[model samples]
Target: MALKPKDIALRAASALVLAPAAVLAIWAGGFWFTGLIVLGGIMLALEWARMSEPQDWRAVGMAVAAGVIAPVIAAHIGQMSLAFVLLVFGAAIAGLVSNRRGGEGLDGAYGVLYLGWPCILLVWMRDLNADQGLYWTVLVFAVAWAADILAYLVGSAVGGPKLWPRFSPNKTWSGFIGGLLAGMIAGGVMAAWLDMGALTAFWGAVLGLLAALATMGGDLWESALKRRFGVKDAGNLIPGHGGLLDRVDGLMFAVIVVAIGRLIVLMIGGNA
Candidate 1:
């Protein structure tokens, strides 16, 4: 269905407010960035809990909150290995708790990995290089945001065949293509402008395309999860955006891919 003017306005307004705050947090780094992420993680956990197991949402929320937060804190303190180990441990704990509470144990565990890993990776990525970290972090945000906005706009305007009606009925092939192009352009421009280490504009665009692909996959995954749980939106946290999870689903997946890619390049002695 076409979005009404009011819905579009609401989305734009929310983005206007939230995007600036997020960017400011990224620029601030350290405690500011970590705090923003922790707050977001908590909100995402609550949404996931309510969506997956409304009956015992509070219990599940607490489990997920603990699961995501500990790893984030560890990452913030420069303990990458410990952060990862804590992530696994937290997931296991969440699973056990959910199972004991008569909820989907596997889903609960998956949620932790899904939400927590990205948070850790994001923190790690921002701390990769004091000088370059800001640029890299901003690049990820820009690409994801560009792709998301363009996809929604183009998809609605050029409404055509569905991309995957099974999971997301409103998604269209046109939107996917639009998002991909936007991601590539955004990545290329950011890289060229910021001069991210040895990464060239061409390579940046390629990474952008990869991130965009991952973003779409992430979106589909969340959609499938919501469908499985029979919820329309994750939660009514944001007016038109649904929940924190709904807003950052793509970013969560893209950040993991980008972080891993950066690490691999660093290890191989490349300056990407």
Candidate 2:
């Protein structure tokens, strides 16, 4: 399939707006950064709830509340474990509320956890250190961005078998391989730019591959969810992106992967 001119223009225009704002917020790496994560989480929750249980305002409310609460817990209390516990509790509440309101309880719970954890982890990643915070956050974004863009381009140019027809028919194996390569290159470049050394650059490339795979999974998951809900797009909130959730779905998953990897390394090094 060929890429549409209008789609390209819209994507470019949207990138023009979103890219600068995201880079600026990440570079700041403080309340500004946290605020952006919070906003993204809330938007994701809203989109999820609206898509999964369209008539259930209670589900939306619960998810959004959980989204807001989780990040606050992470940023203010700085207790990740406690924040996760709170998120679980919130999900339980959301599930119960949805059930009572004649909706799917599991969907409510899923929505909260799906959007909440990533937002908290993103803040946690940025708060790791004053010097390394920006580098780490930007590195993850670079991987996701590079993968998404390259995948789109390659898939359109090298049309072939779908990667997963059941979930995302548009994605192709060619796109997947191309995206992984682009992600690795982007990750290595970012690591070098940060002066993190060759070893770190190699690991960054590896992480980029892992992150790109995770991102593809994330995108597929959302596509499946939308299909389940019989929706074309999550929302029309963003000009080219469809919704904030649409834009960050892959990022949310990639952030968790990168954060977990970082945490494991920190623990092994006795810094966690």
Candidate 3:
């Protein structure tokens, strides 16, 4: 379905306003912003959990555990080792506790990883470096947005072969390629503008492509969870954006991936 001109305008306008607001919030919002994200994670996690364990209170407990603890864990951004331990142990304990909920075992296991793990990564990425912290955050999301937005617009305009029929039937190979190119172009341009190192620029292109795919995986992953749960969307948070999960799906995957990459770079002493 085509996005009406008015819809496009509204989306752009909201994005224009909200994007800067979001940045500023992240910039100054500090740990509370991390807490706010954890709140969103809880909502999304609970929604996913309720799918297979509709009658379970343990699932709710797991969401609560995640909401409270994930932020505490996230607050240890510079302390990667401690944060990583918390995430792993938290997911494990949450998963074990959730098993009493019956068919929700797999659901709980995945939900914790889906909602909580990425949050850890996001915080870690935030504390990666001094000079380019905000720049990197903006680039990661910007590239992901380029991939998603372009794919939707171009795919709707020029439909083609399905990219993944089982998970996302409407996704097209052509659309995927278009999104990749658009993201690469955005990443490349941003890298040039930012005067990032050669390796950083290369990482931007490589990570941009990988993050796009991961972001798509996130969308399909959430869609699968929702389908099993017999829900339309995770929540009605955004007017046209479906829900918090729908909005942050890309971020959920991309952030962790960014975290891992940054961690590796740090382990080896990154250039900048």
TM-score of each: 0.97, 0.93, 0.82
On a 0 to 1 TM-score scale, where does candidate 1 land against the true structure?
Answer: 0.97
Error of 2 at 203 (Å): 1.2
- How does candidate 1 score on lDDT? 0.88
The local distance difference test score of each candidate is 0.88, 0.79, 0.65
Which 10-residue span in candidate 1 carries the lowest summed lDDT? 263-272
Ranking by TM-score: 1, 2, 3
Q: 1 or 2: which has the higher lDDT?
A: 1
What lDDT score is found at residue 130 in candidate 1?
Answer: 74
Query: What lDDT is reached at residue 228 by model 1?
Result: 94
lDDT of 1 by residue, 129-211 (tens): 77577888988898888888888888888889999999999999999999999999988898799957766799789889888
* CA error at residue 10 for candidate 1, angstroms: 1.0
Model 3, 1-272: lDDT tens digits are: 44466766766775675577567646754465566566656666665555546678545556535643554455545665666666666666666666755554555555665576666665555555544555666667777788878877777667878876766677777777878777777666666677444436767677677777777777778777667677777766565566667777766776766555555555665556
Candidate 3: pairs in clash: none
User: Between 1 and 3, whose TM-score is larger?
Assistant: 1
lDDT for residue 144 in candidate 3, whole number 0-100: 74
